[model samples]
Target: MSEKVIAIILAGGKSSRMGQDKAMLRVDGAHLLLRVYQVAVACADNVYVVTPWQERYEDLLPVGCQFIREARYEGDDVKQVETHGPLIGFAQALAEVNVDPEWVLLLACDLPNLEVEVLQGWIEGLENSRAEAIAVLAKHEKGWEPLCGFYRKSCLLGLNKYISEGGRSFQQWLDQNTVDILPDCSTDMFFNCNTPEDLRRRLL
Candidate 1:
């Protein structure tokens, strides 16, 4: 059998830009986190939510969705090294899974248009390209979007090392890996909700 694909939802951000937890934001009738969780469930064998506060995510996450807390900013060597950022979250997740998955589809909770079909397309694209991973490529003006991408769990060690060195930029870590970009066409699947206007146009 092939290695199973896992889905990791990054929900630990301070949500400073949105003024509230983006995962708590509603699009259609479901919370954004739950929506993304549903999509992840559709595409992978397992799903996990990466957050610092399990209580904050209680209402936003569905029953049975596993939660992995990033290592706190202040703690022992293990803790300090694990709280850098998204990489920290991924590291904690890998510890829980105990095996290298074929891929771990990482997604942000702020995008309202991340649906099952789109994610399925991403998985297929990754397989077809024979690339190490597949990420949605934002336009020139938009820059690169890695929040919505697929990664191999075997890379967790290198990612953890980057975090230990105080690297917080996800794009920078991705640069050292084989990443294939899935260009955004007419529709922007990664149109994240950052401002009131963006939320209004996409969520409300």
Candidate 2:
């Protein structure tokens, strides 16, 4: 693909719902993050994992995959740094890796079945849509799938603006933007493991 694209795998969630780090959860004998990383490398020229605990996951990624450290409030005798939410991590990572790419493929690590075919198909769909949408997000009967989608560099300003205005909900932020919704709502690849039960039912 001549159109420059960067893939970003979000792995900085607190995983409080899972009671464990969902990114490290094994699926078919490999970490969920690693599986997502593999698919990303196949779809883009560059790939990055956005997280706060870079050291914890450095060895899990392939040789060339880079890390975009999530911006955290430095702590000493003061405030400390940690994962806040997907939007905050996304904004920080986008600033670091979005080097004038036509599109940015954003992914979440908990998606275990993300194949290269699925990813490439979305990129192709976005290209054919012929719309100047800032984002091309997945949609089903439920709602917009914001995490597993392609975003244009032009979206940076809007994302930052949303955060600046005290917006924390990604879904809420997306509702205000002009986004093309992809109708290939197959749960086979888009399903995410938010809890242990979800992990077993969807990924195991």
Candidate 3:
């Protein structure tokens, strides 16, 4: 059976620790953003790059996959930096689509270790379990990975409410909802690149 899902590539980050845009970083022959778009295409009917710097990635986004900017919606008082996280990106992504898509598969562009098999497993689990949300649990680690997860677009309402209440913890918002956790590999395969050294280690 076909599922009506959309993949929202959260690419609007400063990548301050990595000192560059992680989405533009290369792993294989393609840029990281393209690689992510490939993965998203494998499972989604449509995919989009949610970025604040659309110009920087205009060349990287796939021909058909759209580029939607988040900066356009930022309130006058909220600095760009203030709206730079995945939470803000996710919200903007939903607003741009303007539909409660069946599911939104979110992926952090710097997550080089995100295996397609694991992502497929999460999709299967979420579909089979019939849960409101399903996310990868950082096994043997301290937090839930809210970035690379399956969200029912409806969950955005609660998350938006959380933001209204000044809540910044993504995990906290997920914890308060009907969320299912998929056990992660012990080898830290879900590790995200946040530094040059991390990129070196993963690339080399």
lDDT of 1: 0.72
Q: In candidate 2, which residue pairs clash?
A: none
* lDDT (Cα, tens digit) per residue for candidate 2, span 41-101: 8998888899988888989887766998787665674324555799888888888874666
- Sliding window of 10 residues with minimal summed lDDT for model 3: 132-141
Q: State the lDDT of candidate 1 residue by residue for 68-131, as single tens digits.
A: 8765665566434233466667667766775456687888878788767767766766555445
Can you write out model 3's per-residue Cα lDDT over 87-188, one digit (the tens) per residue? 877877877776545778887787776676766766665565445443434433576777777777776677788888988787777777766666554645
Best by TM-score: 2
Q: Model 2, residue 121: what's the lDDT?
A: 73
lDDT of 2 at 85: 91
CA error at residue 39 for candidate 3, angstroms: 1.0
Model 3: lDDT of residue 71: 73
RMSD of each: 4.3, 2.4, 3.2
Cα error, candidate 3, residue 167 (Å): 1.5
What is the C-alpha local distance difference test score of each model?
A: 0.72, 0.82, 0.73
